[model samples]
Target: MAKYSRIIAQAGCHIHHAEPAQVYEAWTNPELMKTWMFLSGESRESEAKADVTEGGAWSVVNESQEETYRAYGEYLKIDPPERIEKTLVRKETGGQNEKIKVEINSILNGSQVIVTQDVVFLHHEQLHPKTVEEHLREQRRQTEKYWHEMFSLLSKQLTPS
Candidate 1:
Protein backbone atom coordinates (compact mmCIF):
# COMPACT_ATOMS: atom_id res chain seq x y z
CA MET A 1 0.00 0.00 0.00
CA ALA A 2 1.07 3.56 -0.64
CA LYS A 3 0.68 6.37 1.86
CA TYR A 4 0.09 9.91 0.67
CA SER A 5 -1.09 13.16 2.19
CA ARG A 6 -3.35 15.25 0.02
CA ILE A 7 -5.37 18.41 -0.04
CA ILE A 8 -9.01 17.70 -0.70
CA ALA A 9 -11.49 19.91 -2.49
CA GLN A 10 -15.16 19.22 -2.80
CA ALA A 11 -18.13 20.79 -4.55
CA GLY A 12 -21.73 19.83 -5.18
CA CYS A 13 -24.81 20.99 -7.05
CA HIS A 14 -28.43 20.11 -7.55
CA ILE A 15 -29.49 20.04 -11.15
CA HIS A 16 -33.21 20.64 -11.39
CA HIS A 17 -33.92 19.28 -14.86
CA ALA A 18 -31.59 16.35 -15.35
CA GLU A 19 -31.39 12.78 -14.11
CA PRO A 20 -28.45 10.95 -12.64
CA ALA A 21 -28.15 8.83 -15.76
CA GLN A 22 -28.11 11.88 -17.98
CA VAL A 23 -25.55 13.57 -15.77
CA TYR A 24 -23.34 10.50 -15.87
CA GLU A 25 -23.62 10.31 -19.62
CA ALA A 26 -22.73 13.95 -20.06
CA TRP A 27 -19.63 13.47 -17.93
CA THR A 28 -18.44 10.31 -19.61
CA ASN A 29 -19.41 11.15 -23.17
CA PRO A 30 -16.67 12.92 -25.08
CA GLU A 31 -18.86 14.76 -27.52
CA LEU A 32 -20.99 16.20 -24.72
CA MET A 33 -17.99 17.21 -22.60
CA LYS A 34 -16.50 19.27 -25.44
CA THR A 35 -19.23 21.85 -24.99
CA TRP A 36 -18.21 23.02 -21.52
CA MET A 37 -15.14 22.02 -19.46
CA PHE A 38 -12.98 25.06 -18.95
CA LEU A 39 -12.88 28.47 -17.29
CA SER A 40 -12.39 30.63 -20.36
CA GLY A 41 -15.68 31.43 -22.03
CA GLU A 42 -13.92 31.71 -25.36
CA SER A 43 -12.08 28.43 -25.03
CA ARG A 44 -13.39 25.35 -26.82
CA GLU A 45 -12.51 21.72 -26.45
CA SER A 46 -10.68 20.29 -29.41
CA GLU A 47 -10.73 16.76 -28.15
CA ALA A 48 -12.59 14.88 -25.43
CA LYS A 49 -11.86 11.19 -25.53
CA ALA A 50 -12.75 8.70 -22.84
CA ASP A 51 -12.67 4.96 -22.40
CA VAL A 52 -15.33 4.97 -19.69
CA THR A 53 -14.77 1.62 -18.03
CA GLU A 54 -12.77 0.88 -14.92
CA GLY A 55 -9.02 1.08 -15.62
CA GLY A 56 -9.73 2.81 -18.92
CA ALA A 57 -8.04 5.95 -20.17
CA TRP A 58 -9.42 9.43 -20.93
CA SER A 59 -8.18 12.67 -22.35
CA VAL A 60 -9.46 16.17 -23.03
CA VAL A 61 -7.93 19.09 -24.88
CA ASN A 62 -9.20 22.64 -24.73
CA GLU A 63 -8.01 25.42 -26.98
CA SER A 64 -8.28 29.19 -27.08
CA GLN A 65 -6.70 31.92 -29.18
CA GLU A 66 -3.98 32.35 -26.60
CA GLU A 67 -3.08 28.82 -25.49
CA THR A 68 -4.03 25.17 -25.34
CA TYR A 69 -4.57 22.95 -22.32
CA ARG A 70 -4.53 19.16 -22.16
CA ALA A 71 -5.58 16.71 -19.50
CA TYR A 72 -5.52 12.93 -19.34
CA GLY A 73 -6.67 10.35 -16.83
CA GLU A 74 -7.50 6.74 -16.11
CA TYR A 75 -10.65 5.48 -14.45
CA LEU A 76 -10.12 3.66 -11.19
CA LYS A 77 -13.74 2.82 -10.52
CA ILE A 78 -17.13 3.25 -12.18
CA ASP A 79 -20.65 2.65 -10.96
CA PRO A 80 -23.30 3.42 -13.52
CA PRO A 81 -25.40 6.51 -12.86
CA GLU A 82 -23.89 6.79 -9.43
CA ARG A 83 -20.14 7.20 -9.03
CA ILE A 84 -16.76 7.33 -10.77
CA GLU A 85 -13.21 7.61 -9.51
CA LYS A 86 -10.27 8.63 -11.66
CA THR A 87 -6.80 10.14 -11.74
CA LEU A 88 -6.42 13.24 -13.89
CA VAL A 89 -3.13 14.73 -15.07
CA ARG A 90 -2.85 18.18 -16.58
CA LYS A 91 -0.13 18.06 -19.22
CA GLU A 92 0.15 21.78 -19.63
CA THR A 93 0.64 22.31 -15.92
CA GLY A 94 3.90 20.41 -15.62
CA GLY A 95 2.20 17.05 -15.27
CA GLN A 96 0.38 17.89 -12.07
CA ASN A 97 -2.21 15.24 -11.37
CA GLU A 98 -5.05 14.62 -8.95
CA LYS A 99 -7.56 11.98 -8.05
CA ILE A 100 -11.12 12.96 -8.91
CA LYS A 101 -14.18 11.22 -7.59
CA VAL A 102 -17.63 12.09 -8.84
CA GLU A 103 -21.02 10.98 -7.57
CA ILE A 104 -24.40 11.53 -9.17
CA ASN A 105 -27.44 10.71 -7.09
CA SER A 106 -31.06 10.83 -8.11
CA ILE A 107 -33.13 13.31 -6.16
CA LEU A 108 -36.66 13.14 -7.59
CA ASN A 109 -37.16 9.71 -9.13
CA GLY A 110 -34.59 10.47 -11.82
CA SER A 111 -36.00 13.90 -12.63
CA GLN A 112 -33.51 15.81 -10.46
CA VAL A 113 -29.79 15.08 -9.99
CA ILE A 114 -27.36 15.79 -7.20
CA VAL A 115 -23.74 15.87 -8.32
CA THR A 116 -20.70 15.93 -6.08
CA GLN A 117 -16.97 16.02 -6.90
CA ASP A 118 -13.99 15.34 -4.70
CA VAL A 119 -10.54 16.29 -5.95
CA VAL A 120 -7.46 15.13 -4.06
CA PHE A 121 -4.19 16.86 -4.72
CA LEU A 122 -1.12 14.83 -3.84
CA HIS A 123 1.34 17.60 -4.53
CA HIS A 124 -0.02 20.53 -2.63
CA GLU A 125 2.98 22.76 -3.21
CA GLN A 126 2.51 22.52 -6.96
CA LEU A 127 -0.89 24.15 -6.71
CA HIS A 128 -1.30 27.87 -6.37
CA PRO A 129 -2.83 29.91 -3.45
CA LYS A 130 0.19 29.47 -1.11
CA THR A 131 -1.26 27.31 1.70
CA VAL A 132 -3.39 24.19 2.10
CA GLU A 133 -6.36 26.17 3.41
CA GLU A 134 -6.07 28.71 0.64
CA HIS A 135 -5.59 26.02 -1.97
CA LEU A 136 -8.66 24.12 -0.83
CA ARG A 137 -10.77 27.27 -0.65
CA GLU A 138 -9.67 28.47 -4.06
CA GLN A 139 -10.21 25.06 -5.61
CA ARG A 140 -13.67 24.81 -4.04
CA ARG A 141 -14.63 28.23 -5.32
CA GLN A 142 -13.39 27.51 -8.80
CA THR A 143 -14.98 24.08 -8.89
CA GLU A 144 -18.33 25.53 -7.85
CA LYS A 145 -18.17 28.19 -10.51
CA TYR A 146 -17.05 25.87 -13.28
CA TRP A 147 -19.45 23.04 -12.44
CA HIS A 148 -22.38 25.48 -12.28
CA GLU A 149 -21.47 26.72 -15.74
CA MET A 150 -21.07 23.17 -17.03
CA PHE A 151 -24.43 22.10 -15.61
CA SER A 152 -26.03 25.14 -17.17
CA LEU A 153 -24.68 24.13 -20.54
CA LEU A 154 -25.72 20.54 -19.96
CA SER A 155 -29.22 21.75 -19.12
CA LYS A 156 -29.38 23.56 -22.43
CA GLN A 157 -28.24 20.44 -24.23
CA LEU A 158 -30.77 18.29 -22.42
CA THR A 159 -33.60 20.75 -23.07
CA PRO A 160 -32.94 22.31 -26.40
CA SER A 161 -35.29 24.87 -27.89
Candidate 2:
Protein backbone atom coordinates (compact mmCIF):
# COMPACT_ATOMS: atom_id res chain seq x y z
CA MET A 1 0.00 0.00 0.00
CA ALA A 2 1.26 3.48 -0.82
CA LYS A 3 1.98 5.21 2.46
CA TYR A 4 -0.01 8.41 2.63
CA SER A 5 1.06 11.09 5.06
CA ARG A 6 -1.39 10.86 7.89
CA ILE A 7 -2.21 13.50 10.47
CA ILE A 8 -5.02 12.97 12.93
CA ALA A 9 -6.42 15.26 15.59
CA GLN A 10 -9.49 15.19 17.79
CA ALA A 11 -11.37 17.56 20.06
CA GLY A 12 -14.48 17.10 22.12
CA CYS A 13 -16.55 19.01 24.65
CA HIS A 14 -19.68 18.46 26.67
CA ILE A 15 -22.23 21.20 26.51
CA HIS A 16 -24.27 20.25 29.54
CA HIS A 17 -26.97 22.84 28.90
CA ALA A 18 -27.71 22.72 25.17
CA GLU A 19 -29.35 20.31 22.80
CA PRO A 20 -27.53 18.57 19.97
CA ALA A 21 -30.04 19.81 17.45
CA GLN A 22 -29.57 23.35 18.67
CA VAL A 23 -25.85 23.00 18.25
CA TYR A 24 -26.31 21.61 14.79
CA GLU A 25 -28.63 24.41 13.84
CA ALA A 26 -26.23 27.01 15.10
CA TRP A 27 -23.43 25.41 13.14
CA THR A 28 -25.35 25.35 9.89
CA ASN A 29 -27.03 28.73 10.16
CA PRO A 30 -25.08 31.74 8.92
CA GLU A 31 -27.09 34.24 10.98
CA LEU A 32 -26.34 32.32 14.17
CA MET A 33 -22.72 32.15 13.03
CA LYS A 34 -22.40 35.93 13.26
CA THR A 35 -23.29 35.87 16.93
CA TRP A 36 -21.14 33.10 18.39
CA MET A 37 -18.81 31.53 15.85
CA PHE A 38 -16.41 34.46 16.00
CA LEU A 39 -13.92 34.32 18.84
CA SER A 40 -13.84 36.86 21.68
CA GLY A 41 -11.24 39.17 20.19
CA GLU A 42 -11.53 38.42 16.53
CA SER A 43 -14.02 39.80 14.03
CA ARG A 44 -15.14 36.86 11.94
CA GLU A 45 -18.09 36.39 9.63
CA SER A 46 -19.25 33.80 7.15
CA GLU A 47 -21.11 34.22 3.89
CA ALA A 48 -22.95 31.03 3.14
CA LYS A 49 -25.03 31.35 -0.02
CA ALA A 50 -25.82 27.63 -0.17
CA ASP A 51 -27.48 24.98 1.89
CA VAL A 52 -25.67 22.50 4.11
CA THR A 53 -26.47 19.58 1.87
CA GLU A 54 -24.34 17.01 0.16
CA GLY A 55 -22.20 18.58 -2.59
CA GLY A 56 -23.07 22.06 -1.31
CA ALA A 57 -20.43 24.76 -1.23
CA TRP A 58 -19.75 27.02 1.74
CA SER A 59 -17.34 29.75 2.71
CA VAL A 60 -16.06 31.21 5.94
CA VAL A 61 -13.82 34.17 6.66
CA ASN A 62 -11.72 34.42 9.78
CA GLU A 63 -10.67 37.99 10.31
CA SER A 64 -8.13 39.27 12.79
CA GLN A 65 -6.68 42.72 13.37
CA GLU A 66 -4.20 42.36 10.56
CA GLU A 67 -5.30 39.58 8.26
CA THR A 68 -8.15 37.41 7.09
CA TYR A 69 -8.17 33.74 6.21
CA ARG A 70 -10.75 32.61 3.69
CA ALA A 71 -11.74 28.99 3.35
CA TYR A 72 -14.19 27.00 1.26
CA GLY A 73 -15.37 23.44 1.37
CA GLU A 74 -17.88 21.08 -0.20
CA TYR A 75 -20.28 19.14 1.94
CA LEU A 76 -19.65 15.47 1.34
CA LYS A 77 -22.09 14.17 3.90
CA ILE A 78 -24.55 15.83 6.21
CA ASP A 79 -26.89 14.29 8.74
CA PRO A 80 -28.65 16.79 10.94
CA PRO A 81 -28.12 16.45 14.70
CA GLU A 82 -25.58 13.76 13.97
CA ARG A 83 -22.65 14.33 11.63
CA ILE A 84 -21.19 16.44 8.88
CA GLU A 85 -18.32 15.54 6.55
CA LYS A 86 -16.67 17.91 4.10
CA THR A 87 -13.66 18.31 1.92
CA LEU A 88 -12.03 21.47 3.31
CA VAL A 89 -9.99 23.50 0.89
CA ARG A 90 -7.90 26.57 1.65
CA LYS A 91 -7.26 29.41 -0.73
CA GLU A 92 -3.75 29.77 -2.09
CA THR A 93 -2.10 32.43 -4.20
CA GLY A 94 -2.46 30.44 -7.38
CA GLY A 95 -5.65 28.50 -6.95
CA GLN A 96 -7.99 26.70 -4.58
CA ASN A 97 -5.74 23.87 -3.42
CA GLU A 98 -4.69 22.16 -0.17
CA LYS A 99 -7.57 19.83 0.58
CA ILE A 100 -8.32 18.03 3.84
CA LYS A 101 -11.11 15.93 5.22
CA VAL A 102 -13.12 17.40 8.07
CA GLU A 103 -15.74 15.52 10.01
CA ILE A 104 -17.95 16.90 12.76
CA ASN A 105 -20.19 14.73 14.91
CA SER A 106 -22.59 15.37 17.74
CA ILE A 107 -23.84 13.28 20.64
CA LEU A 108 -26.58 14.27 23.04
CA ASN A 109 -27.39 13.70 26.69
CA GLY A 110 -30.79 15.04 27.72
CA SER A 111 -30.20 18.76 27.21
CA GLN A 112 -26.46 18.42 26.76
CA VAL A 113 -24.40 18.15 23.61
CA ILE A 114 -21.09 16.56 22.86
CA VAL A 115 -19.27 17.53 19.70
CA THR A 116 -16.28 15.77 18.22
CA GLN A 117 -14.16 16.29 15.15
CA ASP A 118 -11.77 14.05 13.27
CA VAL A 119 -9.57 15.77 10.72
CA VAL A 120 -7.19 14.14 8.28
CA PHE A 121 -4.45 16.42 6.97
CA LEU A 122 -3.48 15.45 3.46
CA HIS A 123 -0.88 16.61 0.92
CA HIS A 124 1.58 17.64 3.57
CA GLU A 125 4.44 18.27 1.20
CA GLN A 126 2.63 21.18 -0.43
CA LEU A 127 2.97 23.34 2.65
CA HIS A 128 5.54 26.07 2.77
CA PRO A 129 7.78 24.37 5.34
CA LYS A 130 6.77 20.97 3.88
CA THR A 131 5.03 19.88 7.12
CA VAL A 132 3.01 21.96 9.57
CA GLU A 133 2.54 19.31 12.20
CA GLU A 134 3.54 21.63 15.02
CA HIS A 135 1.43 24.52 13.81
CA LEU A 136 -1.48 22.19 13.27
CA ARG A 137 -1.11 20.86 16.79
CA GLU A 138 -1.27 24.34 18.23
CA GLN A 139 -4.18 25.15 15.95
CA ARG A 140 -6.05 22.16 17.27
CA ARG A 141 -5.63 23.37 20.81
CA GLN A 142 -6.67 26.92 20.00
CA THR A 143 -9.55 25.75 17.85
CA GLU A 144 -10.89 23.52 20.58
CA LYS A 145 -10.79 26.40 23.00
CA TYR A 146 -12.38 28.66 20.43
CA TRP A 147 -15.30 26.31 19.86
CA HIS A 148 -15.80 25.83 23.56
CA GLU A 149 -16.00 29.54 24.02
CA MET A 150 -18.36 29.84 21.12
CA PHE A 151 -20.77 27.34 22.63
CA SER A 152 -20.61 29.14 25.93
CA LEU A 153 -21.51 32.36 24.22
CA LEU A 154 -24.28 30.68 22.32
CA SER A 155 -25.71 29.23 25.47
CA LYS A 156 -25.76 32.62 27.06
CA GLN A 157 -27.25 34.32 24.05
CA LEU A 158 -29.90 31.71 23.48
CA THR A 159 -31.17 31.54 27.05
CA PRO A 160 -34.94 31.82 27.42
CA SER A 161 -36.64 35.10 28.11
Candidate 3:
Protein backbone atom coordinates (compact mmCIF):
# COMPACT_ATOMS: atom_id res chain seq x y z
CA MET A 1 0.00 0.00 0.00
CA ALA A 2 2.95 2.27 0.57
CA LYS A 3 3.91 4.27 -2.52
CA TYR A 4 0.65 3.32 -4.22
CA SER A 5 -2.01 5.68 -5.50
CA ARG A 6 -5.67 5.19 -6.18
CA ILE A 7 -6.93 5.48 -9.74
CA ILE A 8 -10.64 5.24 -10.34
CA ALA A 9 -11.93 4.08 -13.72
CA GLN A 10 -15.41 4.06 -15.17
CA ALA A 11 -17.00 2.34 -18.15
CA GLY A 12 -20.60 1.59 -18.99
CA CYS A 13 -23.04 0.23 -21.53
CA HIS A 14 -26.67 -0.49 -22.20
CA ILE A 15 -27.78 -3.96 -23.14
CA HIS A 16 -30.78 -3.80 -25.35
CA HIS A 17 -33.77 -6.14 -24.84
CA ALA A 18 -32.31 -7.46 -21.61
CA GLU A 19 -33.61 -7.04 -18.12
CA PRO A 20 -31.47 -5.90 -15.22
CA ALA A 21 -31.49 -9.34 -13.68
CA GLN A 22 -30.48 -10.96 -16.95
CA VAL A 23 -27.62 -8.57 -17.42
CA TYR A 24 -26.46 -9.07 -13.87
CA GLU A 25 -26.62 -12.82 -14.25
CA ALA A 26 -24.47 -12.67 -17.34
CA TRP A 27 -21.84 -10.81 -15.37
CA THR A 28 -21.76 -13.23 -12.45
CA ASN A 29 -22.15 -16.40 -14.42
CA PRO A 30 -18.82 -17.88 -15.47
CA GLU A 31 -19.86 -19.53 -18.74
CA LEU A 32 -21.54 -16.43 -20.10
CA MET A 33 -18.50 -14.30 -19.22
CA LYS A 34 -16.02 -16.52 -21.00
CA THR A 35 -17.63 -15.39 -24.23
CA TRP A 36 -16.56 -11.79 -23.75
CA MET A 37 -13.49 -11.72 -21.49
CA PHE A 38 -10.80 -11.42 -24.12
CA LEU A 39 -8.36 -8.54 -23.95
CA SER A 40 -8.96 -7.70 -27.58
CA GLY A 41 -10.35 -9.02 -30.85
CA GLU A 42 -12.01 -12.42 -30.98
CA SER A 43 -12.68 -14.20 -27.68
CA ARG A 44 -10.33 -17.03 -26.84
CA GLU A 45 -10.04 -19.89 -24.48
CA SER A 46 -10.95 -18.65 -21.03
CA GLU A 47 -12.21 -20.17 -17.82
CA ALA A 48 -14.03 -18.48 -14.96
CA LYS A 49 -15.57 -19.51 -11.66
CA ALA A 50 -17.44 -17.49 -9.09
CA ASP A 51 -19.05 -18.15 -5.76
CA VAL A 52 -21.28 -15.09 -6.23
CA THR A 53 -21.71 -14.22 -2.58
CA GLU A 54 -20.17 -11.69 -0.26
CA GLY A 55 -16.79 -12.94 0.98
CA GLY A 56 -16.86 -15.70 -1.60
CA ALA A 57 -14.08 -16.08 -4.20
CA TRP A 58 -14.01 -15.68 -7.97
CA SER A 59 -11.40 -16.04 -10.65
CA VAL A 60 -11.01 -15.65 -14.40
CA VAL A 61 -8.15 -16.81 -16.60
CA ASN A 62 -8.03 -15.57 -20.18
CA GLU A 63 -5.53 -16.95 -22.62
CA SER A 64 -4.07 -15.34 -25.69
CA GLN A 65 -1.43 -16.28 -28.18
CA GLU A 66 1.25 -14.62 -26.13
CA GLU A 67 0.15 -14.71 -22.54
CA THR A 68 -2.32 -15.92 -19.99
CA TYR A 69 -3.95 -13.30 -17.79
CA ARG A 70 -5.26 -14.18 -14.36
CA ALA A 71 -7.68 -12.25 -12.19
CA TYR A 72 -8.87 -13.42 -8.81
CA GLY A 73 -10.79 -11.72 -6.04
CA GLU A 74 -13.39 -11.83 -3.34
CA TYR A 75 -16.94 -10.59 -3.49
CA LEU A 76 -17.39 -7.67 -1.11
CA LYS A 77 -21.02 -6.93 -1.76
CA ILE A 78 -23.79 -8.54 -3.76
CA ASP A 79 -27.33 -7.38 -4.30
CA PRO A 80 -28.75 -9.62 -6.95
CA PRO A 81 -30.01 -8.08 -10.20
CA GLU A 82 -28.90 -4.66 -9.07
CA ARG A 83 -25.31 -4.22 -7.91
CA ILE A 84 -22.12 -6.00 -6.98
CA GLU A 85 -18.87 -4.88 -5.44
CA LYS A 86 -15.71 -6.87 -5.33
CA THR A 87 -11.96 -6.83 -4.89
CA LEU A 88 -10.15 -7.64 -8.11
CA VAL A 89 -6.47 -8.54 -8.38
CA ARG A 90 -4.90 -9.05 -11.79
CA LYS A 91 -1.79 -11.10 -12.33
CA GLU A 92 -0.61 -8.87 -15.18
CA THR A 93 -0.75 -5.82 -12.95
CA GLY A 94 1.51 -7.31 -10.28
CA GLY A 95 -1.54 -8.17 -8.22
CA GLN A 96 -2.71 -4.62 -7.68
CA ASN A 97 -5.88 -4.38 -5.69
CA GLU A 98 -8.79 -3.08 -7.74
CA LYS A 99 -12.07 -2.52 -6.03
CA ILE A 100 -14.77 -2.90 -8.65
CA LYS A 101 -18.40 -1.97 -8.29
CA VAL A 102 -21.02 -2.57 -10.93
CA GLU A 103 -24.51 -1.12 -11.02
CA ILE A 104 -27.36 -2.47 -13.11
CA ASN A 105 -30.28 -0.17 -13.61
CA SER A 106 -33.50 -0.73 -15.47
CA ILE A 107 -34.21 1.23 -18.60
CA LEU A 108 -36.57 1.28 -21.55
CA ASN A 109 -36.69 -2.21 -22.97
CA GLY A 110 -33.28 -3.07 -21.55
CA SER A 111 -30.74 -2.50 -18.83
CA GLN A 112 -27.72 -0.26 -18.34
CA VAL A 113 -24.63 -1.12 -16.38
CA ILE A 114 -22.02 1.16 -14.93
CA VAL A 115 -18.69 -0.23 -13.88
CA THR A 116 -16.51 1.57 -11.39
CA GLN A 117 -13.07 0.19 -10.86
CA ASP A 118 -10.83 1.79 -8.28
CA VAL A 119 -7.35 0.37 -8.50
CA VAL A 120 -4.13 0.96 -6.59
CA PHE A 121 -0.97 1.31 -8.58
CA LEU A 122 2.62 1.93 -7.58
CA HIS A 123 3.97 5.35 -8.43
CA HIS A 124 5.06 5.60 -12.05
CA GLU A 125 8.69 6.04 -11.07
CA GLN A 126 8.58 2.76 -9.22
CA LEU A 127 6.40 0.70 -11.55
CA HIS A 128 7.46 1.46 -15.08
CA PRO A 129 9.83 3.36 -17.34
CA LYS A 130 7.02 5.57 -18.58
CA THR A 131 5.83 8.52 -16.56
CA VAL A 132 2.94 7.81 -14.22
CA GLU A 133 0.66 10.02 -16.24
CA GLU A 134 1.52 8.23 -19.43
CA HIS A 135 0.88 4.85 -17.85
CA LEU A 136 -2.44 5.97 -16.53
CA ARG A 137 -3.40 7.44 -19.88
CA GLU A 138 -2.55 4.21 -21.66
CA GLN A 139 -4.55 2.26 -19.14
CA ARG A 140 -7.57 4.47 -19.70
CA ARG A 141 -7.33 4.02 -23.44
CA GLN A 142 -7.17 0.26 -23.13
CA THR A 143 -9.94 0.19 -20.62
CA GLU A 144 -12.20 2.09 -22.98
CA LYS A 145 -11.43 -0.20 -25.87
CA TYR A 146 -11.87 -3.33 -23.83
CA TRP A 147 -15.18 -2.26 -22.37
CA HIS A 148 -16.57 -1.18 -25.70
CA GLU A 149 -15.93 -4.56 -27.23
CA MET A 150 -16.98 -6.45 -24.19
CA PHE A 151 -20.28 -4.64 -23.93
CA SER A 152 -20.95 -5.16 -27.60
CA LEU A 153 -20.48 -8.88 -27.23
CA LEU A 154 -22.48 -8.97 -24.06
CA SER A 155 -25.34 -7.22 -25.77
CA LYS A 156 -25.37 -9.86 -28.46
CA GLN A 157 -25.66 -12.64 -25.91
CA LEU A 158 -29.14 -11.69 -24.80
CA THR A 159 -32.43 -12.09 -26.65
CA PRO A 160 -33.76 -9.04 -28.40
CA SER A 161 -37.13 -7.64 -27.44
Best candidate, TM-score: 3
Q: Order the candidates by TM-score, highest first — what do you get?
A: 3, 1, 2
Cα deviation of 143, candidate 1, in Å = 3.1
Give the best candidate by lDDT.
3
Query: Candidate 2: what lDDT?
Result: 0.56
Candidate 3 ranges beyond 4 A from true positions: 1-3, 123-130, 159-161
Off by over 4 Å in 1: 1-5, 91-93, 109-132
lDDT of 3 by residue, 1-161 (tens): 33555667789988888999899888899998777654445336799898999999988888778778777899999999999999988754666778889899999989998988875655644565456667677776666667777788888888664
Output the worst ten-in-a-row residue range by lDDT, candidate 3: 35-44
Model 2 C-alpha RMSD to native: 5.4
For every candidate, C-alpha RMSD to the true structure in Å: 4.5, 5.4, 2.9
- Model 2 residue 89 CA deviation in Å: 2.3
What is the C-alpha lDDT profile of model 2 across 83-131, one tens digit per residue? Answer: 6666555543123333433233443542444444443333445565445
**lDDT score, residue 108, model 2?**
51
**lDDT by residue (tens digit), candidate 1, 1-161:** 22223455565666666777888888899998777554367784477889998999998788888888777889999998788888877642345557777778777634344444554434434444456556556766776677677667776776536
Colliding residue pairs in candidate 2? none
TM-scores of the candidates in the order shown: 0.75, 0.62, 0.86
Model 3 steric clash pairs: none
* Cα lDDT computed for each candidate against the true fold: 0.68, 0.56, 0.79
